[model samples]
Target: MENRTPIPDLIRLATTTADVDTLLQMMETFCHHFSYPFDRPLRQQLIRQMLENPSLGSLWLVVDENRPVGYVVLTYGFALEFGGKTALVDELFIEEGHRGGGKGRTVLQQIQQTADELGVSVILLQTEKYNPRAKRLYESIGFVDQERSTLMWKRPN
Candidate 1:
């Protein structure tokens, strides 16, 4: 028999209550890595609220040996441009010590598979322009740069 290794079940949807603490810890790490200051209590409250609402978004925890090491968030939208449903990979973060060993690519592939299963016609994401390493990984996985438009955002005060 040919030697075959089991495919690891690393990517999984985060449970509303069961995975809240793990998700929060990963979110804090993500914010720190990207230099975004957040109010912990408010953030926690928001996450809890979102967990109760399925339409808000979906969060997945990347685990190894049943312990979470990273997370990804996908927010949904409906648009005629994409012919139906679309989703944005809002955030993807792998802990400091757990990075740079193909985990990122594995997680992305799993995301793609999940998108296919969820009837999402399009999956979108953006990274800083200067982050060449991330850009390369995204491209390697068949994500193309959209040249026709730029992403803009507005924050309500």
Candidate 2:
């Protein structure tokens, strides 16, 4: 007998408005876990936008035996430095109970495959400095620190 980690069945691309509620709920949980502010209206709007225009990105739901266990948000971009198409792993959240069972790694592997198929020249992601576990997981799967600070600016509303 051999022991094997079960491969999670991730819903690769969320393509309908029907997934909004699940996405919002999971996103809220993710925000809380990371101590980030949860803005329902803004998040809802963004989810709707992504659903309406897949060119913007994709949302993947991690499922186990028909139950939703986690979700991932991947957004697209283009940069001359990256040779054109790029994908950002905007968010990846595995429910608390589902963590540490290889689900996250499996999902990331699938994401990489999808990106390759889409002609993405690069895949990028950021992890919170406070979450060493996540950083380790990412590094174990071939994501490396770019050795550059990531600065952001939000336009005034």
TM-score of each: 0.89, 0.88
**Model 2 residue 26 lDDT?**
94
Residue lDDT tens for model 2, 48-142: 89888878888888887867888999899999998999999999988999889888899998887777787899999988878898899999999
Which residue pairs overlap in candidate 1's backbone?
Answer: none
Give residue 119's error in model 2 in angstroms: 2.2
The deviation in Å at residue 98 for candidate 1 is: 1.1
lDDT per residue, candidate 1, 22-124, as tens digits?
8888888889878889678987887777678868778889888888999988888888998888889989999888899888888888888778777899888
Q: Can you tell me which runs of candidate 2 are displaced by over 4 Å?
A: 1-8
Task: Supply the global lDDT for candidate 1.
Answer: 0.85
Q: Which stretches of candidate 1 lie over 4 Å from their true place?
A: 1-7, 16-18
Task: Pick the TM-score winner.
Answer: 1
The local lDDT score (0 to 100) that residue 51 gets in candidate 1 is 79
Query: CA lDDT, every prediction?
Result: 0.85, 0.86
